[model samples]
Target: MFFSFWNSVVFIIICLILFIRFDTSDSGANNLHLFDANNAAEMFGNDVFFEILDPEVLRYTYRARPAKDFGVTFNETFYQREALLVPVEPPDSCGWPKNAHEIEGNIALVERGDCSFLSKTIRAQEVGAIAVIIADRRLVVDDDFYIEMIDDKTERTPQIPAAFLLGINGHMIRKTLKELDMRYAVVNIPLNITFVSFHEMNQPPWMIW
Candidate 1:
């Protein structure tokens, strides 16, 4: 009887340990490196950012500005999503995507122009992109100010998130992918911006200050 009681006790202990470990891992998965508002303002200025979490060599945070009048807005509730950043086939994404199979369940990186911002987002949304990042074709994106992605007066609005990226940053991302022969890059979007100092934040090595 004593031996049976001991066995039951041991089983309970083992179950408890497993449960604790699982809970810890789940919590850790949701936690991300945070940056204070001062850090965010200094580093990205008016832009928000996303982090490249995979291909350790390409791990860096890039600047972006969320659209004002369309799609879901970024907030605590909309944070903590990880997705593959895949470039559209036509780049502009004016028409239906040729690589819809690859774009589905991922974020589409479409070039700005050739269509209204709304149209580009709609095309990506139709193919099941969780979000869209419109990259400017010009070298400078309005001198660090966000170019408003106004409503195109379309009857339907995109249901997913959309943001604008600077041409230089976008070109670098595409160039790096091509050089590495990678089809897509793993990314964590809409990272929570805290009020921590830039020095305390987990800054990528490639970024200068």
Candidate 2:
């Protein structure tokens, strides 16, 4: 009789432990939502604004490449230059384990291919990234590419700033760093800006007017 009583007590204890763990996990997730940029800014006196670029907007593109390919022999410059390279995989499997962390404050260097541009930007934003730069894998292709974010089933639309660069551009940027005996350098290019108009209709004025 004593053995059975002890067994019951042990089972009850285990159940209580599991319940507490589950509750804690749920609470943690809830806390994360509260830290979202929009909410955090409001609570902390930080200013946040939305900048929506129509189909056309003036933007710049940058590049990344292997240093060895370029004869450049500088290491200090390269280290000073930091670009958040996004691995070509699911957010959970991306090459940079701290991709989100780095992107929050620095420029995000993302690999082209696999998943939509939107998915990459959204993932970056989750980690606090302010801007995004995508690198193409085709080093030889010299063409302009468009970036689109993946929405999946979620209603949230990614509204982060983003840009794209050719594979060669990336390589050249790396090369420039090496030539200057630097690990990296900032490559800025000017983009053309175009304004778009929104259409709205007004009701006809009443005869009394």
RMSD of each: 14.4, 20.8
Off by over 4 Å in 1: 1-47, 139-146, 199-209
Which parts of model 2 are misplaced by more than 4 Å? 1-96, 142-154, 174-209
Ten-residue region with minimum lDDT total, candidate 2: 200-209
Candidate 2 local lDDT, 96-192, one digit each (tens): 3353444455445565666655565566656665455555555465453323233455554654555454335444443433455542234222211
Taking all chains together, each candidate's TM-score versus the true structure is: 0.71, 0.37
List clashing residue pairs in candidate 1: 36-194, 36-195, 36-196, 37-194, 37-195
TM-score of 1: 0.71
Winner by lDDT: 1
- True-structure Cα RMSD, model 2: 20.8
Across 121-206, the per-residue lDDT of candidate 1 in tens digits comes to 89999999988998876554545354777788877778988988754667667767878888888888776655655555565554
